[model samples]
Target: MAVLSKQVAVPKSGFSPIPVIDMSDPESKHALVKACEDFGFFKVINHGISAELVSVLEHETVEFFSLPKSEKTLVAGYPFGYGNSKIGRNGDVGWVEYLLMNANLDSGSGPLFPSLLKSPGTFRNALEEYTISVRKMTCDVLEMIIDGLGIKPRNTLSKLVSDQNTDSILRLNHYPPCPLINKKTNCGKNVIGFGEHTDPQIISVLRSNNTSGLQINLTDGSWVSVPPDHSSFFFNVGDSLQVRLIS
Candidate 1:
């Protein structure tokens, strides 16, 4: 586990540089494309997802993570289910654990959790509802982006994700709070949480608790910490989208 000086943490300020887009507004498509071109990341508001649904899933997630380590391990599997510390096979480690699920399990991918989950049925239901809503929002955003780009057939980008065979994934990440360091040095250290990396998919939609550690690299190569907003989802253009656009 690599540690970095606390100085690396940027303090939250009154103003934020991250672009905010209102998804309900048709004119926002222009801003959406501009944000993608400029920052490749932006916050979305009026996304049409229910707050009640979000809360239900979050509550279920908390209960799931609170399970005994032994019980939680029941769902453990490579590339899916429960993962702790180590992320991917690249040997990159972080102070985080996550639950990864295939977005579309209906195409005969089989059940994701074989025998775990204290309330398996309830958990699965929550997952299904949340996934359906978010996936729709993702397609909507994609179509808007395509419209702004003046591309033929706005569904060009949206259809890829909307397909039943789409390999989209839903990941729920949990970052436990790490204890503060020695009072003597006064320069506290922090653990690396999901060490710096970019999403390789078409796009990534993320939401987190009030705790704020998410940061994005700018076009100029400087890192800027994003303020946490539990009510809104954050979207980032992935490498696949960039490749698609360029091609």
Candidate 2:
């Protein structure tokens, strides 16, 4: 819960100047490599997903999370369904709830909406479509990363991590506004919406609503806030990717 003093500057204009890459551009390959090498994260634009679909996905997500806690518990399962704590069994808990599910394109599986919501609506269908789109984009970015590292896409690194059967999880996180924003806990730390932690996957592609709270820890021991711009997706290289890069 230690705070850092230096903050990364966020652009407030036409587009973010913070390593925003257009995936459709061929020149973006070099930028992708540089962003990963320097910060291990970057924002991507011109990703093939449509804005309408994005809106649909976001609306459905908000609806799903807005359900009563008792209703949400129906689809709850370990590490794969609805969850509210960042650190399980720990005294401190983040003000976040998430629905986790496997996002394998071949399986056509989507987020676990309640059975009550299985009627003729766009919620389930939109989620399925969005999951497939995001999965494809994830694979595309992984392939680009492999190419950046001068490794063949068909090589072991790419094949193992990018395999359709691999344990690729899609997490929809909702960080509710903390009620005790001005108050501190016994540990002298403010209530965390989402605790600082690294992801366990090879990489994570995150899209957020314009509520900016994401931060990245720089190598020089400084933390930088990543202001949300709903137009782009944030790509984060995870622990596995770090290990691969270093080794």
Candidate 3:
């Protein structure tokens, strides 16, 4: 969890002025809408997801990643299981590895790597609990957005995600540090972890370790580094939501 400095252009203010919304506050609804309209991104606090649950899930995830590559590859596949470096069917690649799982899977569906890990049960249990908690928080946030917009039927947006058949995904990304290549020639820059991209879902909820390297493109065409807050969740308004707002 060491802090790694990023070699990219930063906001002139030297800080990310991303909007912070407190879920417990009744007046936060309007602010949430404003954040979506302005930056399409914001940080949420006062979310009820417990620190203990987050810690447990993070520990299990790290343990899984620490396993030898051969063992980790047991669950390797595209669109649903473990993936390393390669992103999507395209030739895109990044300096990261990830595990993508279907969030709607039944709790008793069993572990993704039951025979590969010493504590497979623990990993599966942690994943289920974490997904359930995060899904709840996502619904709450969506409801707030609906309220802020004065949309008919408060559940308009929330229902899309809360439904049993919802096509939701949980991605765990690990960006391991790489040695700098030819410092002077490379301008002392680290390889891009994941290239610039927009989420195609209605919304995306993201949380990461204390290390900071994330950046968001602003409406005015400037990019600002997102300050890391491992305890708080960040929400991104995706393409579907943006189109829905206009239509």
Q: What is candidate 3's lDDT per residue for 160-244, written digit by digit as tens?
A: 8888877888889998766654666885385778877878888999897898888886544566788889999999888888777
Clashing residue pairs in candidate 1 are: none
| Residue-wise C-alpha lDDT for candidate 2, range 140-247, written one tens digit per residue | 777777777777633445465456687777778887756656444545356667777777667778888998777776545655678888888988877777777667
lDDT of 1 by residue, 127-202 (tens): 8899899999999999999999999899998898889888898888887765554557754465678898877778
Off by over 4 Å in 1: 1-16, 107-115, 179-188, 245-247
Who is ahead in TM-score, 1 or 2?
A: 1
What is the full ranking by TM-score, best candidate first?
3, 1, 2
Best by lDDT: 3
Task: Give lDDT per model, in order.
Answer: 0.78, 0.70, 0.80
Counting only residues 3 or more apart in sequence or on different chains, how many pairs clash (N, Cα, C under 3 Å) in candidate 2?
0
